[model samples]
Structures are given as C-alpha cells and as structure tokens.
Target: MKTAISIPDDLFVTAENTAKKLGIPRSQLFAKALEEFIQNHSKEKITEKLNEVYSNDTTKKDNSLSDVSVAILRNSLKNESW
Candidate 1:
C-alpha cells in the first residue's frame, strides 16, 4: 500500500538515518511505526472496555474465599525449591 503523510524535518532525517543504519527502507520504518501505533491504540480500546465493564459490575467479593485462595497459594509456594 502507498500513502503520503507529513512529518517534521528533523524527525524525517532521524528516521532516514535509522532506517539506513538498520538496512531497511524508509517505507518499512514508517509502516512498522504505524503498525505499532495501531496495536497500541487497540490495546487502549480493550483496556477502556474492561474498565467500563468492571465499573458497571456489582459483585461483592467474599473475604473468606479470598483468604483461602491466598493460603493455598502460599502453601504451594512454600513447597517449591527456588
């Protein structure tokens, strides 16, 4: 895919140099950066959805159940040779 975009001159030079140093074309560098940007934005969207769901939940946690789980975890860890 071919696309045109504008960026600062210093950044452009830096990207060009970095791409040359890494032996990859400037287009690949931009593509990789754009791909990372999309991935990061997708993660942000997922986090936002999770936060929304948690905020709307009304479940109360049982202290005894949590304590038992923690105790079991501690017991399991104690027997491990580290």
Candidate 2:
C-alpha cells in the first residue's frame, strides 16, 4: 500500500537519516514505526477498558492477603536483594 502524508522538514530529515543508519528504506522505517505505534495504542486501549470495568464494579472485594500468606511471601523474598 502507498500513502502520502506531510511532516515537518526536521522530522523528515531525522527519519531519513535514521533509515539510512539502519540500512532500511524510508517506507519500511515509517511502516515499522507506525506499526509499533498502533500496537502500543492497542495495548493502552485494553488497559483503559480493564480500568473502566474494574472502576465500575462495586462488588469487588479487597485483595489484601492473610497475615500468614504475607509472612510466607516476605520470608520467600527475604533471600533476594531489593
């Protein structure tokens, strides 16, 4: 697929330089960048949906662990450095 879009000259020059440095065509660079951008926003959308669902649910109980469980977890992690 072919498309045309306008961007700032400085941005265009930087992208061109980056493409050359990476030994890929300008189209490939733009395509890869756009693909990553779309994927990242897709993840963000999923996170937003999950947050909305959890926020609207009033029946959700506290997720705190029992004292014994917390003690076990803390003991397990004690061997590891922060």
Best by TM-score: 2
lDDT of 2 at 63: 33
What's the distance in Å from true for residue 30, model 2? 0.3
> Candidate 2 regions off by >4 Å?
60-82
Tell me model 1's lDDT, rounded to 2 decimals.
Answer: 0.92
Q: RMSD per prediction, one decimal?
A: 10.1, 11.0
CA lDDT, candidate 2, residue 67: 58
Task: Please report, as a residue range, the 10-residue window in candidate 1 with the lowest summed lDDT.
Answer: 56-65
Which run of 10 residues does model 2 get worst, by summed lDDT? 57-66
Q: How close is candidate 1 to the true structure, as a TM-score?
A: 0.68
lDDT for each of the candidates?
Answer: 0.92, 0.91
Which parts of model 1 are misplaced by more than 4 Å? 60-82
